[model samples]
Target chain A: MKRVLIAAALSTTALTATSAAAQTEIEFWHDKTGRLGELLKEQVATFNGMQSDYVVVESQKGNYSEVLNAGIAAFRAGEQPDILLVFEVGTATMMAAEGAIKPVYEVMAEAGADFDADGFIGAVKGYYTTNDGQMLSMPYNSSTPVLWVNRDKLQEAGINPDVDLSTWQNVGDVLDQLKAAGVDCPMTTAWQSWVHLENLSAYHDVPFATKENGFSGTDTELAFNGPVQVQHISTMGEWARDGKFIYAGRRNEGGANFRGGDCALFTESSAGYAGINAEAKFEFEVRPLPYWEGVDGAPMNTIIGGASLWVLAGQTDEEYKGVAEFLNFLSSPEIQAKWHQDTGYLPITSAAGDLTREQGFYDENPGTDIAVIQMTANQPTANSKGLRLGSFDQIRGIIDEELEAVWSGDKTAQAALDSAAERGNALLRRFEQATR
Target chain B: MEKRVRFKGLWLPLLLVMPQLLITAVFFFYPAGQAIWQSLFIPDPFGLSMRYVGLGNFEFLLSDPFYRASFVTTAVFSILVTLVSMGVALYLAVLADRLIKGSGTYRTLLIWPYAVAPAVAGVLWLFMFNTRVGVVTWYLGVLGYDWNHVLNQGEAMGLVVVASAWGRISYNFLFFLAGLQAIPRSVIEAAAIDGARFWTRFRTIVFPLLSPTTFFLLVVNIVYAFFETFGVIHTITSGGPQQATTILVYKVYADGFVGQDLGSSAAQSVILLVIVGILTIIQFKYIERRVHY
Candidate 1:
């Protein structure tokens, strides 16, 4: 009798929930935190207020790597959400999960949402799209590497605050001056492999790996140990030995050092603006990523970092439609412009960039549009397009270890990169064979 | 002499042990069996297709230089952790056991570190040694000693070992304190009356009787260092400075979750299982022989 009454009560609650609002529930899992998380929540609230057909429930699931791992584990258990935000490095892993994800193009078309593939900036879209130019995921918080200058530190080090750091040569001279002026850490970097190697290759129009950085096929091999990369690494190694370049941990551990006013120069993601702007007491400025002046066609645009939103497969039609509508709302120019302004992420569409410019945001906040201009300034070459390789995340780990050897003076720049390339190639071959 | 009792009905005895048997089969045996099976085959991310290659993954790992280096690292780490944690724990337990009135308070205070999670312990140690803002690092710097674990292999390994061992000391301390209390006080008192010093009494009388607990803790601490310290390594070093602290378990995680290579990870796990099995067998054999001494 008790079980019968419990079942009746549960059924009554369920009926009331459905009858009051027949809202299709879409679970959107992400890894944004702090101000970015608040902004995402605000967007969700706005969407929910705009219409009542669908209620998007957003959940913060750990950091970037944790979220991807959780999404995969959930999919294997057949309990994945309708949408997942995956970091850029996990693009290959997500793409290889056949039948586990629904391409955004198909979701948009099925839902009849107005999504123009051409509206997205080419360089940003190229990273997540197929060979046939189909976008597999929506680029959500794209960022590129840039030089972060602490004006106070530079001035305190007896260097001109308005000095040009547009070239690596000029930056090296300034670093020497800062070191001579008794600055402890003249320069530090976050995401060493990303800023120093990956973006360095792209900014100089060189291939980080073969087969167009693994976009053509799975048989790609590492080519980042070339002369241009070696030169840059050897220079950094010299700086490290001279106590000018401090080697922080692999990821964004140096962000703390830079924000704490201990470092004079930091090469980090443009999304660093949100943090530096918030925590940095000294006057700091975002400058264009430095390039090697010796190389021809140098200072090319950089590739995107950050993450994108992928629509997972196996949800119902109505649920997928809800996901599509949400993404479409997120892609609208007004929302994109606001997200770009708020988070310092790249405006995904040219329209958003133009809108922000028309609103005089660029004039109000100088150097705010540098990332957008950097990404859209040039047609990305075959080498500068982006890397989409299997086992890339692991390969990055190998590269980080080898680079640390150089920083410690245990190995030469060429030797470290060479060893790193060799070790990375073995993993690539294993990945190729595994996915074959 | 050994005494044994036999139940009247076999079915009743089997029924009595059914729950234990069922749990073992579900949790332990099932996963072990799956890992063994998966080691022989490589599956895609979606598990849509699997290619059977018996012993292929094992062969690859055997040839990998980094995998072999991790073995040496794991051995060094496990030994250091066991020795440091147990040695410190034994010393603390002996001290607490000597106290007549405040023994309970000392025991309670010593066991507090056991409550800290391994990851939290690692983060605490990391902050203290962080190159940028660490108070300890800054003090070391002032004393003309540069402490940068990011580039120094030995420092990285040292940091992980200390962090891992710090969390295990409380558990070992609890067991050691209990074992000390269990020893007959009259035996030590009689030795003391005979003009034996404290160290002599502890060495000659107290140490021999506490051998059982010591052996037990050695085995437990070794296993804890092996399988349970991945969180410490992950939070602290992440197996860096050229894989200085990448133990077998850490490698399994790095390859499986970070690299998305399940087959190799499973193969590594199977290898780790065999190592643990041998270690456990050896430990139990030693314990059996020492328990009678």
Candidate 2:
């Protein structure tokens, strides 16, 4: 009789636990920490409060590459989350994993959620879309490279803080003056390959790779060793030799130097504004990225960096419905505008941009709209639409090595770029084979 | 007379050793077999499909100049790390053994670094040597010396090597100290009464007595330098400035995890395993002859 009573009690407890969890749970794994992480949690709480049928549980994985690796491993083990945030470079890898992901368009359509494909900015949307205009991932925090200026440093060098630096020629003059004035670090850049090679080709309206930068097919060849690219790299190499340019690292290690008021000029992502605003003690300004004056159709459009949200496969239908709803909530104009104003990431949708402008965010923060204007100044050419190539992360490593050789005066610009192209092409061919 | 305990039956002996055999099979053999099998094929990102390439992965790696250069880099790195770490540990152990008072405090302070994880050790070193904001870099600048390891291959390699060897000295010190304490003191006292100085006595008596510990440490340190030290290389240099410090193990991690090229990484591990096997055989065959025990 006592055993029967204990079994009944256990059954009652299990039933209550199941009943309390009636809301369908959707798991979201992202690579954000600190302030961004806290903001994401707040957004999730607001969403859960507004709804009754679903709850989104968000988790912070490691950095970009780590998150991609973890997602792939989880998929293989049949334990993947419902949503993952993959970096821009991993687009090709994710797209190739057909059965591993559920495209955002299909998820939105099947769930009948309010998603507008046309609402997104062209350059931002084009990066994560198929050739047929179907969206693959939900565009999130997109950012473009811009030039950051230390106004006090410029003034200390007896130069105007508002000097025109629209052209590389003008920037070169400034660099020479800064060097002459005994500035140790006149100019330094983060994301060397992205800013100097990939986006430089896009801004100059030249091909970075064949087959429309790998949008049409997988058999694309690297063309970044062209004369224009070589000329640009040669100029930078000369600057390095003269101590006018500092190469801190392959990634954003230069951010600290720039924020510490050591560098007069910095070329970094627009997303750097958050950290610089928080840490920099001196006044600073944001300016459009400079382009060479001689190139035709120059300063065309810069490509996007940062990441997007991708829905994974193998979740229950109810879970996918919750994912679609949460994504819709995130892309709403109020939410997106708030995120853009808080984090300095691009407002991905037109409505969000308009809402931000109407709310006086751009007026209050001068020079913050440079990235948007730079990206939307002209229709993106075939080259400016951004890259879609497999093994891009590895190719970037090769580029970094070659660029370092040039910076250290071990190799000429043309020689280093040629070698980089050769090595990068070999990897591309290997990727082509592996996917085939 | 020799005393031995004999098992009653084969079943009892086999049963007694079953747990160890099972653990070895599960932990070592299973993963090794997986690596060997996976080395022959390239799988898709989702692992939904695998394409067999036979010896193609090996062929690619062998032909790649970067991969070939890593072999030399790994050799140089392992040799330098083993020599520096072991040499320093032996010297410190000798000093500590000679201490008549406060030896325990000195020994405890020396052993503290061994408790730090390799990655944490790497981060600490990186902070002190950071180019833009490092304290050491600032001090060097005040002395009219410029230090930028990001673009300097030699400096990057030196920094990573020093950091890798720094944490390992404590581990080697423990063994050397134990070996020194185990040595009988009567022989040394006799040598002293015979008018032998400290250096002469150490060279003729104590040095030979510590040969077994040195030999054991030599083998272990080589293995440690080869397979471990990935964290230090990763955090400090990341195999950068033209792949100057791209050791073999770091390459395995970069390719397999970051690059998602599993087949090549697996093939490289197989080659590494074979190389280590050959090295162990050589050490046992030739180097063992000089060891006293």
Candidate 3:
């Protein structure tokens, strides 16, 4: 009699819990912590409030590289999340992951949503697309390199506050003046290889690698050791020697110095505005990335950084449908515009940009539009589209090591670039061979 | 009589050892075997397909200049870490052994650092010596020494070595202390009464008796330096300033996790396994021969 009573009570509890669990759950793995993490949670809450059929569970999964590692390990264990956020550099690896990911275009089409591929900005969309221009992933947070100037520091150094810094020559003159005026850190840059070499090559309309920067073929060779690249790197090396440029660690380690008002000029992602706006007590300004005037096609559009959302395979059709709906909700003009204005990421769509402009957000935030203009100023050339090389993350490490050598005055700029290119080519060949 | 208790039946003995054998196979042999197997093939990122390239990965690693440089760096790093940690620990143990009161308090205080994780220790040291805003760096600057490890290869290497050794000193200290306490006090007293000074007593009697402990520690410290210092290097220098601190293990991690070159990383792991095996064998052989000393 007692056992039967307990069994009846357990069954009743089970039924109540089942009824409460009606909503399907979708797992989202992202690489945003702190402010971005809170924004992501807010978006998830809004989506959940708007729906009764699904609940999206967002989890912070470390930084970009760590998150990618987690996703790969999870996929290997057959326990991957429904959605994975991958940085721009990992696009080729994800694309080559045949039978692993479901293309975004197909998901939208299957869900019967009014999806327009052309709605996204061309430069942002081109980075994660197939050869025929089919979208592979949804652009989540797009950013481009820009010049960040501490106006207070510049003025303290007795330099003109409105000195034209649109060209490298002008920036050089300013750097000399800052050095002469006893500025400790005249210029420091985050992601030196990205801001100094990669974007520099793109803005000069020079190829960083052959075969359209590996978008057309995997058998591409690094051409970043060309005379234009050599000239720019050697100039930076000279600046480093003269204490006009500070050699910070790789990957945004210099952000602290720049935002702390110790640096007069910083070349970093436009996304830095969110952090700078929150922490910087000094006046700062965002300006266009300077171009080298000697190049024929100087001031070309810069490539994109940040990450995109990929739809992993091996999920139920219902889950995919839910993912499609959630993505559509995220890309809505109001949400995209709010995310752009709040986080300093580029508005992924033209409609979102238009909405943000119509709301007069650009007028209030003057330098926020610099990243968009820098990315969309011209139709992307073959050189400026973006890199799609396999094993590019590893190649970036090699480049970083060589760049550090140059900064330390251990190797000549030309020698370092030549070595970096040679080393990078070996990895590229290995990648090509493996993929084939 | 040989102190041996033979099992009545062989089945009982076999059954008694089965659990341990199963655990060793499951935890150690299985992963090692898998690494060896994977080292011979290159797989796609998704691992949907694999292509066999026998010994190709090993060849590539052997030919890579950075990998070769990492081997030299690892050797230098392990030697420095083992020497520094063991040397400091021996000194501390000797001082504590001489104390008659408050010895337990000293031991307790010294063992506290062992409880801190190696990665956390690395971070602590990095905070003190960071080039831009570190307290130590600022003091050095005031003394006319501009310390910048980001550009200085020697400074970067020294920082990682110190960070790695600092966390290990506590562990080595415990072993050395125990070894010192295990020595019979009578032998030291006789040496002292026979007109020998403190240094003479330690050299003739105490040092000879402690040879076994030192030998054991040599092997243990070498292994600790080789395998356990990755966290310290990762946290502090990240093998930076021209790969000056990039040891073998750090290279393996960078290639496998960051680079996603699984075959190369696997081959590197296999090489490390063989290296460890050889090192253990050499230690055993040498220690056995030197036991009579």
Candidate 4:
């Protein structure tokens, strides 16, 4: 009798759920996993519970590349989700996909959703905006590269744990000291191309590509082979030869070494805090990414890494309204603040950052504000705004290969960067022609 | 009288072969035709816009130094994987055949690695050679020889080759063991009675009778190394360390799925198809001539 009652209860719930078909379902496909995935699902549930007209469903589509590919494939088949999470490098590809996506601003205007374009932080907003200041996509889960120091390892190397690593010169001196003190891995890095070449060009206020890093037009060529980038890579190469810097794999393979207390320093995404804080047995600190002192506008700003939510085209009016409402919910101060605290991603809006500070979250967790400060410290110049090149994912593969050549001593920095630029420009030309 | 069975009517024979023909058309010919068609044009990411280039992609790829270099790399990788896997399997099969006791258990143990997927096998090997926490890397460090496959080209190639071959050894071993067991005992006994040594008898008698199996495995293993080892390379090296391990198939995946350049990827697949076709033809026409069966 109890089993029959349970089955009857389930049947009733299913019937009620079918009867409430008035709730327009909004499908959101993203690439977040682990704690972040859970938090995203929680936000979706909260949004669903807070309203009667909309029910948001979330799905994981593997990593960033997989998500983009899946989105494209689905779009081709006329079965696309309401929203897609595309990484920053794919901005150009998404933008050129003319009829495949609906701009976020248009969605807001059509649905009469509350959206203040100016409320978003300048650096983060500028990445996904056009020259006429139109937002293309909703910014979400953005982060910048920073320096992570293993405090225990520093002290063991006879160096002060509080030593300032603001400048590359000071970091070099500390690396020498750590090497002399018998440390095997003085420094290591993840996302070598991002932290070394792309971010280095932006932070030093040098162009990574011509035509304002491809924001102005698609006919741009790579300019990262310039003197500034070459010098930075050359220094890293020298350090690799000196045993002061250890070369890891192309991606975040060094995170394991650093978290295991085998490396003294790691240059990785600020979002790495979510993993490092939970796994590290030793104390660690986050610092602003170092810059060279001699550059004219050194330490200007670091661009964001991580993905943003883009509204896809060809959805019903009701579904679009649901999507717009969900996006608005995501941008609210409480939700954004909680997300920023839970993950190390930057809060998209100034109101969210202010709310976190007012709640004393940053005070309780020191160094949590470094990414925001570094991003908003200066008005982003044309060079520092962000890269928006076509086929940038492939271009980054070329850059990774060239960078590996430099690290392995197979080629000098200048030669490798030159080859990378030449190869990357070929893909850029192909992109331009195909889009045209 | 002829031993071959004769069909009564044309319609019956056609109906009997319809399922296989349908399956082949859907699975093989359709995709191959689509790849050829797509290779002639460049399609945008959404596939809504397609511009005809008329062999432009092939021209560009033929001129690319990196693509040309990958051809050489694939040649070296497939050759090494085929030789190593086949050689080791043959040696193990010979040893297992010589065992009088517990041979069944030995054969079962030798066949276990065939159960592992290519990607899983790659990860297992990667964990052992990882620079930071790898047990073998640590041991090598203690022995005063550092093993950093991430940076070393030769080491990267060697590691991927071994990892690709490790999973294939089980498959080859099973075939070799069956082929060895099928050899008639009377011939070996007669040779032994004539005062012939074990090495001479095996080389002259057993090897000749095993030629059919050997030739078949040669063709299959070569094809396996060329096509199916992509998972192993992708999981282990991702065609890295300056594209040292970038086999043709891995390049096809990187360009098509990851890079989103469908036209170039299609063109590459067509080229790979032609290469494999030529390889199979050469093997059948030349290598099969030496087999007695």
Candidate 5:
């Protein structure tokens, strides 16, 4: 009689808890921490408040690599969250994971969610799409590299505030002038290899790899150590030797140096916007990443840097419906516009950009629109759609090492490039064989 | 006679040792077995690729010039850091042992660094070593050290070795200090009474007594230099300036996690294991055998 009473009480408690929870909780895993983290929480609250059946619970994973690693581990363990934020580079890897991910288009169509692929910026959209434009992921926090200038430091060095440095040639003169005027640090770059090599390749309309920079196929070869690449790297090496371009450690160790107002010019991702905006006491401006004027087809559009939200496979129809609805809510113009304005990430859609413009947010913040402009200014060639090689993250490390060698005067540009290409291509071939 | 008979009995021995034996086989041998197996197979990032080619990863590593170069660098790094740290730790431990006043405080303070997490230590070292805003860099500039790890290969290696030693020295010092305390004062007093000076007493008496500790430290420090230094190195130099300090473990991480060449990375790990195994065997067979204690 006592055991039956206990069982009845337990059932009553479970029923009450279920009634309290009424809504289905969908899990969201992202790499945002601190301010961006807070913004996401706010967004989640807004969505939950608007809905009666779904509650999106957001979790803060670690930085980009940690988040990616966590997601991959979770997927393997069959405990992956409903939505996973995979970086832009990992899009290829995620796409190629046969049944691991359900493309966003399928989910949207199945749930009849309101989404227009045509509303997204072409280049930003292209990075996350197949050649025929089946959107695989939703581009979130899209940013391209740009030149961040400390105008106060430039002024301190007696340089004109309006000095044009749209090209590397002009920047070289500015660097020399800053040096002559005893500027301790004239120019420093973040993601030294990425900003200097990868974007430089795109800016010069050169391919970073063969086979459409690995977008079309697996058997791709690195073409980064080519002549144009060599010249740019050698020039940076000369700058490092000259004390103009300081060799900071990898992983944005120089961000602090730049942030401290010790450096005049910084080449960093547009995603650095939030950090820079918060820290910089001086007047700062964003300009297009300078290209070498001598190169033909110079000043080509830059590619995106931040991650996108990939819809994972192996979910019930209701879960898929939840994902579609959540994504549709995330893509609404009001939400996207606010996200773009708040985080300084590019508004992923034209409608979002138009909303921001109509609201005069762009007028209030001038260079906030530069990332969008840089990414959307041109029609993306196969080469410029962005890299999708199987082992790109590893290849980036090799390029980083080779770039370091150049900076330290250990190797000339051609030597570093040749060796990197040789070594990197070996890995590619091995990757190709292994993947095959 | 009864204990000897029990030791000789298989059932008795097996019952006593089964847990530890099983644990070792399950954990250590299993990982070793898996690493060996993985070295034979290649892994692709996507689930698309899983191919086995016998001895392919090993041959590829052997032929690769970059791996060869980093292997030698790893050797140089491991040896230099182990020796320097052991020497410094021994000296400090001896000095602390001899101090009459505030000895406990000194010992406690010295062990404080050992309590710090390795990840935290890496961050602190990076902050101190940073070129522009680093306090140490400014002081070095004032003192004419010409030190900049990011731009110079030698300096980068120096920074890595120093940071590795700094992170590891406290634990080593603790061991040596404990070993120092274990020695009886009467033996050293006898040496002194025999008109033996400090240097002679240290060399003939104290050094022999500390042999076991030194041997233990040699093996431990070398392993620490190989595995633990990678994080701090990655934080500070990132095997940079010119790939000057990219050691074996850093290469493993870069290849396996970042590069996604799990098979080749396993091959590198296998090679590292073999190299460490050979070194450990040599130490046991030769150096430790010759030690007095």
Candidate 6:
């Protein structure tokens, strides 16, 4: 009797929900919550309202990493979503997978969707593009690293809040002054491995890894233990030992330190704009990430972060078309422009950047366009482009471990980096063998 | 009569037992067996990579430096947290027993943390230890303690221990409270009247009765600290200002999922399983005997 009643209730619930309506439903799963998640929902709602022939249902799967995991797990179970949002680090891993994903360009072309390949910003597009210019994933919220200055703290430290901080040498001097001025937390950072080793390598025009940072081939090895990376790490170690640079835990724990107005200076993502704007009562400024003084091409553009939307394989053609329409809508210049202006992630397209500029938004905000400028300042070198190695996420954990040792005064900068490269490369070999 | 007995007793019992055995085989044994197989064969989840590595993965783990550190950290954390929480839980349980009127109310509030998800517990403890915005940090600063986990190793260790303990305190409270309630009050009262002080009373009177509960909690708290505390550790520390907090499970997650290094991750998982298994055996062989009933 109970089982029969449960079956009747389930049928009633299903009838109340869908009523067997045929609207070509497409599942769009993401990892954004809070303001970002709300924004995503709003976009989906707009798309859904614009048409009756198709329904684009966007759902919050989890956080960035969790969503990726869920996507992969679902794909294995043959229940993958039509669209999946993936962060930059997972790009190489996804790309390395043979049949788990369908390239975005193919999906766009298959749907006969109106997509101008040239419309995407080169830096943003290049990260997700193949060697022959085939787009792999749609860039949704790409951000580059920049120095976040708590202007109030610097001013209180008796230093000029607007002083040029484009070079590490100058930043070091300023840190010393801040320390002398009784600032306990002069500097902290988010994504130390990224900002320190990654953009650090790019800014200096040096390779972080061979085989084009694992893009051209899986046989890539860590080149970060070379002189440039070692020097930067050693300098940071010196600062850490001197109490000038506080070592917050991995991820963005130090972001709290920065946003709380305790830390005088921070190196973090440009997309941190929303949080800092909301929580901080102190004056803050965004500047280009500091590069080492005297390095050739020391101020080259940094790589992109944030995340992108990936259309998974194993979906029906009609669902693929909906995904295409959704991607195209998301790519529209007005949509892109407004998203960039509001969220502080880079405008993914040239037209969006132009629109943002024409609206006088960049000029009005002063530092709002700095992320764009830093990313598009110069042609990217082999080193300046994004890393795309299999097992990169594991490799980053190894890097985190080594970097921590340096912070704790257990190992010197060179030693820590040497250990990281050696350990990271062994995993690289294992990954290479697996992929081969 | 024989046919009736076979149909009623043996066949019916077999039918009733089938579902549980099937579930165990499918859910638990299946994945574990696959992990062991995958570790030896070294198949990438991506399907683009597969290799016969044999025991190469294990050999790599044995030689890895961070492997040693993670194993040590997990062992140390599990051992210390189990001992500390057990002691604290027993003490609190005795105190609750003394409160004849408000015992239920105290028990309810005491096990409140048990209702919180591990991730939530981690976040709450993180709020307390946040160097910039934390209540504990403010007090620690006032007391002139070096309280920054981001900069200090000792402080980082303290933060991990605090977070680990807070997450399990709820379960411990529940377990200990139940054990104390089951203990007959006449024994404790007799010891008290025989001129026993609080400590002496606890040692000679109520202690023997609570042994079974203590045994259960010892195993439980050990498993929790080893397996369950990773959520808190991952969120609060991500294992360090350096690698100070990277335990076995953290490395496993980082390697298998984050790094997408399936082989190495599997090896790490195997090691974790072995360690926990050994601990379980030790508890059963050595500790279970002490239980009074």
Highest-scoring model, DockQ:
4
Q: Which candidate is the best by lDDT?
A: 4
For every candidate, how close is chain A to the native chain A in TM-score?
0.96, 0.96, 0.95, 0.96, 0.94, 0.95
Model 6 ranges with Cα > 4 A deviation? A1-23, A51-53, B1-23, B46-50, B98-101, B167-170, B173-210, B289-293
Task: Tell me model 1's lDDT, rounded to 2 decimals.
Answer: 0.91
Model 5, which residues run further than 4 Å from truth? A1-16, A20-22, B1-8, B46-49
Cα lDDT tens digits for candidate 2, B225-293: 998899888888889879999999998898888888888889999999888989999988998888775
Q: Rate the local accuracy (lDDT) of all candidates.
A: 0.91, 0.91, 0.89, 0.92, 0.83, 0.83
lDDT winner between 1 and 3, please give it.
1
Task: Judge the docking of candidate 3 as incorrect, acceptable, medium or high.
Answer: medium
The C-alpha local distance difference test score for the whole of candidate 6 amounts to 0.83
Tens digit of per-residue lDDT, candidate 5, span A1-436 = 2243355557678775564355565778999888988998888899988977777778888977677777777777777778999887677677777677889988899998877999988888888888778999998778888999999999999999679989899999999999999998899888876788888888788999998888788888889878888888989899989989986766687788788898999999887888999998899999988889878777778887888998877777877888888898888899999999998888999999999999999899998898888887888777677887766676777887888878878789899888888887887788677756
Write model 4 residue lDDT over A168-278, tens digit each, in one string. Answer: 999999999999999999999999989999999999999999999999999999999999999999999999989999998989999998999989999999999999999
DockQ computed for model 2 against the true two-chain complex using alpha carbons = 0.79
TM-score of chain B of each: 0.96, 0.94, 0.94, 0.96, 0.94, 0.91
- Residue-level error in angstroms, candidate 5, position A56: 2.1
Per-residue lDDT of candidate 1, residues B55-79 (tens digit): 9999989998988999999999999
Docking class of predicted structure 6: medium
The local lDDT score (0 to 100) that residue B156 gets in candidate 1 is 93
lDDT of 6 at B215: 84
lDDT of 6 by residue, A1-436 (tens): 2243355557767664353254667788888889888887888888888987678778887787788888887887777888889988888877777688889999999999999988988888988988788999999999988999999998898999989898999999999999999998999999888889988888888999998887788888899988888988998988998989987766777888899888999998999998898999898999999888888888887998878888888778988888899899999988899888888899999999999999999889999998998898988878887888767777777888788888777888888888899988988887777766
**Clashing residue pairs, candidate 4?**
none
Residue pair clashes in candidate 2: none
Between candidates 1 and 5, which one is better according to TM-score? Answer: 1
Docking class of 1: medium
Predicted candidate 3 versus true structure: per-residue lDDT over B1-293, tens digit per residue: 34787669888899999999999999999999999999998877668778899999999889998889888999999999999999999899999999999999999999889888889999999899987889999999999999998889999988988888887889889988988888999988888888999889888877778888888889999999889988888988888877899998998898888877888889999999998899999989877566533
User: Which 10-residue span in candidate 6 chain B carries the lowest summed lDDT?
Assistant: B1-10
Candidate 5 chain A worst ten-residue window by lDDT:
A1-10
